[model samples]
Target: MLQEKIGGEAAVDARALVKTFGDKRAVDGVSLTVPAGSIFGLLGPNGAGKTTTLRMLLGIIDPDSGTRSLLGHTQPLDASSEVGYLPEERGLYPAMNPREAIAFMGALRGLPLAEGRRRASVLLAERGLADWEKKPIRSLSKGMAQTVQLLGTLVHKPRLIVLDEPFSGLDAINQEKLEALIRAEAADGATVIFSTHVIAHAERLCERIAIIAGGKVAFAGAVDDARDRLRPVVRLQTRAEDGAWRAALPPGARQVGREWRFELPEGGPEPLLRALIDGGAGIDTLSIERPGLHDAFVAIAGASAAAAMGEGAPE
Candidate 1:
C-alpha cells in the first residue's frame, strides 16, 4: 500500500478491481490511488487493460469484483457533477459551432447552457481559439476540434478530470499545447488523470504512475522510485590507456572509443575513484547516469511492453 501525503486526500481510490469479458479477464486485481491536486498517469501498452480499468473507475462499467471511489463518492456517478471525462473515442456534432459544442458538454454535467456559453467564450480566447469559437466543428482542423473538446471537458471547472488517450491523433504542436493545458489545470487545483502507452508524457507530467501489463498492475508508485530499481550507470574517460588501475574496473565494464562504461559498483563509486587516482589513472571525464523512465519501464514490465510503446519509447 502506498502512503498518502500529509493533507493530500485521494481523488480516486480503487482496490482489487477485476473485470471479465467472456473467457478473457481484462483486468485482474488492479489497484491505484491518486491524490487530489496531482497528475496521475495510467500507463500501459495498447489493450493492456488501461481503458477497462478507467471505465470501471468512472462507473461507466462495473467491475466483477473489488471497489472504487471517485472524489469521495462511493458511487462514481453520484459525483458526476464534479468530474469531467474525455473518452479515447472523440465525438462532437460536426455541424455544431465550437462554442455550442463546448456549452453542450457543460450542459451534460449540469451546467446551465448560458453559463456554459460564457465560459466557452473565455476558454476559447485563452486557448487562442477565439476566432474559431463560432466556427462549425466540421470547418475546423482535426487538431482544433480536439482542442475544443478538451476545452469543453474543462468549461464546467470540475475538480477531477479524466482523459483517455488524449494525445492520440495530435501533431507535435498540438501535443505540446495539450501538455500545457494539463499543467495549467493542475496548477489551478484540478486532479488530472490521463491514460497513455507513451512513457515520455507520463515521465514528463505525472507525479505518480501505475504501469499495467498483461491485465495486471506491474508497478505503481512515484516516478523516481520506479527508476531507482536499476543501478546508476557510470561512464569514465581516463588519461591512462593501461595501468594497475585497470584492475579496479568491474567485471562487466567495457570500453568503446575513449570512454569506459559500466554499472556503478555495489560498494559505491568512492572506492573505485580512490583506486584510479592512487594508481595514476588520470580521470578526464566521469559521469554517473541515472536510468530514465523508459529504462525503468523496460526493467519493470519487460521488453515486450517497451516494444509496445514503439516509436514513442524514449531513446
Candidate 2:
C-alpha cells in the first residue's frame, strides 16, 4: 500500500497543551513528537489526562493553551480521512452484522460502501472471523465484537492510527492478536499511537513513549533512553560465603541466600570481578541487568502511579 505522506516526517506534533475541567486541570503542558510510521505509546494511570491530551491532538476538543498538528494539518480533523481513531468507548449497533459494522465505520472515514465491504470480508477471513461475519454484533462475544471494530478502523488503511486504551478488557489471546494487528499496520507504513497503562504492552510495541502522571508529562523519548535513567544491576553468587572480596561490593549491596545483588559499580564490573578472583571469593555466577520498562516507569512516574495501572481502567 502506498502511504499518503503529509506534514514532513512527523505524524503528530503537540506543544504545551493544557486542558481544564471545572476546578480540575485535566492536562497540563503536555508536549511530544511522534515520528511518522513509528509505533508510539501514551502511557499513564487512569485520570492522568492521557485521553484529554489525545482528544486535543485529534481536534475533538480545544486545548486551553497549546498548539498541535496532525498529519501536517494545523487542524487535526482536516486529516480525518487519513487517520483512524478507536476511542476508549467500544460500541457497535447490536443489530448490525460484523461485515456491515466494519463497512459502516469505514464509510464514516469516507471509504465507499462497496470497497469497505470488500475489505471487511478480507479482514474477517484473515482474522479467522469469516464464520462470524454475518452474525449480528449482539450475538458475538465481547472480544469478537471488539476485533470487528478494530478491523473497521483499518479497512480504509489509514496513514495514522490512534487507539485509546486498546487493550482494556481483552483476554490474553485477544491482546496478543491486537498486538499482532498493530505490528502489521506499522509494517505497512502506517503510524500507530496507542494509549495504555499496561507497561508490558508499551515495552513490547512502542519505539518511543510519553509517560504521563498527574496530568503532566514525566518523560518522553526513546524506550531505551527511559530505561537508561537508572544504573544496571549486578546479581552474583559466590562459592565462598565470606571473603575480603566482599569489601569491593558497592554501597546498597544486599545478600540474600548466598547471592549478592547491587547496582553496578560506577567503575564497572571488571574491577569487582578481579577483586573476587584475587580474594578467592569463588564466583559461581555473575550477571548484569538493565532496568525493564516496568522498573523505569516506577522510577519516573512514582510508585503510586504504577500502582494505579494495576488497579483497573481509568475513568
Candidate 3:
C-alpha cells in the first residue's frame, strides 16, 4: 500500500489505470498518487493520453482495466461529488448569469441550493467578478467566462480539484489570479491534480508531477528530483582579449562569445575552474550551462521515442 503523507489522507490514488479506444491504448498502465493538500500536475505532449487519464479519474469515462479511488470512494461518481473538475473544453450556459450558473454547479457538487448561492456570490466577488455578477454569460469576455467556469468548479469547495488546461484562455492578469487560487486551495488543505502542456506552470505550482508520453510516464516525482534528473549545467564566460584562459574544461565543453560553457552531467559536479584547467581547455572566465526543463523533457521523451523506433538509437 502506498503510504499517505503525514497528517494527510490519500485523496487520489490509481493503480494501472488502463483504457483503450478500439486498438489504441489511451491510458495504458498509468498509476499515480495524489496526497492530501498537495498540487500534482499531469504533463504530456498533445494526445499523450492526458485527457484519457483525467476522464477515467472523473468517471466521465471508464477504463478497460485497473482500479481507482478518490476520497475513499471506489466508485468515481461518488468521489466526484467531492471533486471539482475543470476540463479543457470550456462549457457554460451563455444565457445564464454567473450567480445562477455557479450555484447550479455547486448544487451538483452536493452543496445545498441556498448555501451554493451564498458561496457563488462570495466566490465571484473574490475573483474580481463582483461587477459582473448579474451579467449574463454571453455578455462576458472569454477570460470572464473562463473565470466563471473556474468559479463553478470551485464554488462548492470540493476537497479535490481536477483542473485540465486551466490557464488556456486567461490573460496575464487572470493567470496570476488563477495561480493564486490554486495555491490558496492547497494551503486550505485541498488536493489539486491539474494537467497542462505548459511546463512552466507545473514547474511553478506543482510540488510533484508525472510527465506522460505515448500513454506512459516518462518522469514522475518532486520538482527538485526532476531538475536533478535533467541536471541543467551552468555557463561561465571568459574573454580572450580581456582575459587569458578559464582552464581545464570537461568533454562536450564549448567556447562561445569569449566564454567557455560546460555541460555538467548528473552526479558530476566538480570544481568547474579546476576541471577546465585540468582538461587543457583553460580560459580566463568560466560559465556552467544547465539544460532547462523543456530541453530536458525533449531530450528524455524524444530520445525515448527515437530509441524505440531504432532511429537515432539514443545517441
Candidate 4:
C-alpha cells in the first residue's frame, strides 16, 4: 500500500517537526497526522513540547526544521483561516463584551465584522450564553468565559479546531457541556485536536492519541490499539483482600496492590487460567482488566522521561 501524504486524509499533518529556544530543544522531531473529522489528543507532562508543537501547527511560531500542512494549505499564514484555536491562557479582553470579543476573533481569521457578529450571536445563543452576549467579559464567571472563548474559536466555522487545555477552568457540569459541544462539532465534520494533561478528558474525547515526551512522540495511534499493543493484562482478585499473593504469583505477572496482571505474550488466557487453578488459589473471580489510557500514558512517557534524565527508570 502507498503511504498517505501529510494531511492526505488528515486535517493536520506534521512531519519531523522541530522547534528550539536558544540551547533548549523544545520540540525535537515529532510527526503527527490528525485524521479529518476525528477528535485527536496530544498529551505529555510539563515542558514536553506539546504547546510548541501546537504553535507550529497554528503558524504562531516557525519550526526550526520539518514540514506541516493544515487544511489543504502549507507553510504560509493563509492556511490558518482553516483552523480555530483556543490557547491555554484565557484570551478574551477583560473589557470587551461577548459580541465584540467573539467578533474580533473572527475578524482575525478574516471574517467580515458584520458576519462575525452575526455568527457570534447564533453561536452564543446555541451555547446557552445568549443573555450574556452583551455583558462585559470580566463579569462572566470562569465557566461562562470559557464558553465565550469557545464561541470565538468556532464562530468562523473553520474545518479544524485546535484547543490547548480547553477544560482548564471548567466545573464538572461545564466540562460535560463543552465535551458534548466538541463531539457535536466533530460529528459535523470538523477535525479536533486538544492538548491536555487530564487523562479523563482525553479518554472521553479522543479516538486517537499521541503521547509526547522530551519532544518526541512516545506513542501514537488509536486509544484501544495503543493499549492493546502494550499487553493484554487481566487482573484476578479474591474478595477484596490484601495479602502476599503477589509474591506467590507467576514470574510473568506484575502485581498492583491486591491484584495480579499479566499479558500472555504469545498465547491466550488458557495457560494462566490453568496455572491459577493448578495452584489451588482462592478464586473469587477472574476478570480481564484492560489497561486504561492513563496506564498506557505512564508506560509510554515513563521510558522517555528516563531517557531524558540520562538514566534507566528508577527501581
TM-scores of all predicted structures: 0.95, 0.95, 0.87, 0.86
lDDT per residue as tens, model 3, 63-108: 8899988788888898877899999999899889998889999988
Error of 3 at 26 (Å): 1.1
Decide which is better by TM-score, 3 or 4: 3
User: Taking the tens digit of each residue's C-alpha lDDT, what string does model 4 give over 1-315?
Assistant: 122333357777788998889999999889988888789998776688988999998888999999988776796377787789999987789999999899999999889989999999998888777999998999999888888888899988988899998887789999999899999999888899999877778888999998888889988888987777566566777553444444445578765766666654355677666665555666676776577776676677775553452434322
Across 1-315, the per-residue lDDT of candidate 2 in tens digits comes to: 122233357898888899999999999899988989899999999999999999999999999998999988999999999999999999999999999999999999999999999999999999888999998899999899889989889889999999999999999999999999999999999999999989999999999999999899999988999999989988899888888988888879988787788889888888888988998889889999998888889889988899999932221
Local lDDT at 215 for model 3: 96
Q: Rate the local accuracy (lDDT) of all candidates.
A: 0.92, 0.91, 0.78, 0.80
Which scores better on lDDT, 3 or 4? 4
Quick one: ranking by lDDT, best first? Answer: 1, 2, 4, 3
With candidate 4 superimposed using the best TM-score fit, by how many Å does residue 17's alpha carbon deviate from the native? Answer: 1.6
Supply the global lDDT for candidate 3: 0.78
Q: Candidate 1 at residue 148, lDDT?
A: 92
Weakest 10 consecutive residues of candidate 2 by summed lDDT: 1-10
Q: Count the backbone clashes (under 3 Å) in each candidate.
A: 0, 0, 29, 0
**Which model scores highest in lDDT?**
1
- Alpha-carbon RMSD of each model: 1.8, 4.1, 4.4, 4.3
